[model samples]
Target: MIFLAIATCSGSAFAYRPFDGTDAAVAEPGELEVELQPAGVQQEQGTRTLIAPWTVLNFGLSEEWEAVFEGRGETPLVPSGPTELMMGGAFLKHVVVPGSLQGKDGPSVATEFGVLLPDSTGDSGVGASWAGIVSQRWDWGTIHFNAETALTRDHHADVFVGTIIEGPSKWKVRPVAEFFYEKEFGLEETVSGLVGLIWQVSDKLSFDVAFRHALTNRHPVNEVRAGLTFAVPLRFEGAHNR
Candidate 1:
């Protein structure tokens, strides 16, 4: 059980649970979504695993704006023992361009800005994080680009750039893939790739499974993960009695 209490994912991915990525949209006002992913990996010499659950809470601040809240708990299997980490944050998202079901030409554009709070050591981990997210969506697929820079208590800095991609979504099952790269201020670079699928059971429930392989020999090893995502819309009861 290994966990990385990294970014607080925005509320837009259900078919993209395997990759640590987000979409360019936010939940409707008063809508809540939760995702649980339990995945691991196998390598030449050892294995790595993680069980983490994150919740996305969104409230429509306006017609085109949403306030987002995300929180997650992770328990990772490490060489010493199982370590627990908690991460959460609040974010704001604006849908600059909206995509429609029939619209296939233009891309939906959105931006997210947030701060990350993590419970970990200052030496190898982050004390705080400042992140900016940009996403684009077309008829064929979607792309999420992330740039994150963290502040460490010990005067160290780390930065990450992640690119997340998913294929066409007009089917019961859709293909999802990702390529992620990270570089610490003074450390070597690490790169990873993943391929997976998103199974849509219905509009409200879905499942995702993915396998990650290391492009660089230094980090990530190999991993297999699966998760479920569901959304529940908040509604007010109406009086039906005559």
Candidate 2:
């Protein structure tokens, strides 16, 4: 049995749909980006977890910064549990050095820091986290690296390191893969892998699907996920004139 755990919201950043890590890119200023997972399922040790919906909202504050909010509702199917809201976070992402991720010449560098809020159950206290990101792009494909550390709700420390590989951006449908390892001090260590595809419907919309397998402290877990990402420009009086 393998049980892998990273900072909960950390793995849920969703830089590019269906993947766990994030890219070093911020939303365009005054633009809003939304990520939605209408339904997702996870199975572990004969127990099933269902996420009817998971959501993340990113608002571009400037060319170099973005604000992020994420939350989800989950239910245990096999054990028969009521649906409950869990894992909420608020973060700020900043671009330290713009590069390939921004259509420039080198790898882009960024960082995200924020507070992890308690769930609806109010069983845990507030926590905080920070993450670093680096991403590069090429005619062939794109790759991203992430490293994060968090002060967990239990007041323990957690660390996560991961990488994401993506197929050529020119393709309407691109292949994506993610590999990660994480450890929560005084708790457990985890290893996981995921493979998926993203369909670029247009410059502002995308759809994705992925499958993941993990070994979390010797417990085997499997998951299936699908989602969509879209961006909308914020309109204001004379906004376009700026």
Candidate 3:
């Protein structure tokens, strides 16, 4: 009876993947990044699909800082149910060190803080979350790790630990994989893993599709997700600014 309650997207054109865990970098000052998921599915006793669409909008405010907005509208695959908007989130991310996008460098680090806003003021609820990230560029590919904690409106706390290893980018399509574990206070723990691909269509556009399966019985059997991400330059401090 576990659910794929939360999902995320991040910068890969600038140095991360859409479906992978977040990287230790933020959008450059004056840059804009958007991710759109056209289709996503989760299966438990039966198939539960998300058709209302999911989106993430990121705006660069400074060289090492970015403002983010994420929202997902849910329409469970029932023929007669109306779509109910889920909680939306707003976050601020700061990069402590700008890591190399490519190379065998040490790593980049960042921190993020955010709040979840309920779709309505009808006492639905809210949540707060924070995360720390570490990422490194390797000869073979890139690696990223995230440690996150959240306090939902119900006052329950949850923790997530995730990591991603993306394949080399010499080709138009790159393979990526990740493993994640989550622990919910007063609830059963769950472990899951993902395998996906990043299709770099251009400097500003990328597409991704991924399959996630639960490693523990506390979650849905599997999930299928496909999305597209695009980066638009608002303004740049310099030529090297992405």
Measured by lDDT, the strongest candidate is 2
Model 3: ten consecutive residues of lowest lDDT: 1-10
The 10 consecutive residues of candidate 1 with the worst lDDT sum are 6-15
Clashes in model 1: which pairs?
A: 1-76, 1-77, 2-49, 2-76, 2-77, 3-76, 29-60, 39-225, 40-224, 41-223
Preferred candidate (lDDT higher): 2 or 3: 2
Query: How would the candidate models be sorted by lDDT, starting from the highest?
Result: 2, 3, 1
Evaluate residue 73 in candidate 1 and report its C-alpha lDDT on the 0 to 100 scale: 46
Q: For model 1, give the RMSD to the true fold.
A: 5.0
Better candidate number, 1 or 3, judged by lDDT: 3
| Alpha-carbon local distance difference test for all models | 0.58, 0.82, 0.69
| Candidate 3: tens digits of C-alpha lDDT, residues 106-190 | 6888888887666532464777888888888766787888888887545578788889889876668989888877776885577
lDDT of 1 by residue, 16-72 (tens): 366655565666666665556543434523544354544455666665577666554
- As a whole number from 0 to 100, the lDDT of residue 234 in candidate 3 is 86
Which of the two, 1 or 3, has more TM-score?
3
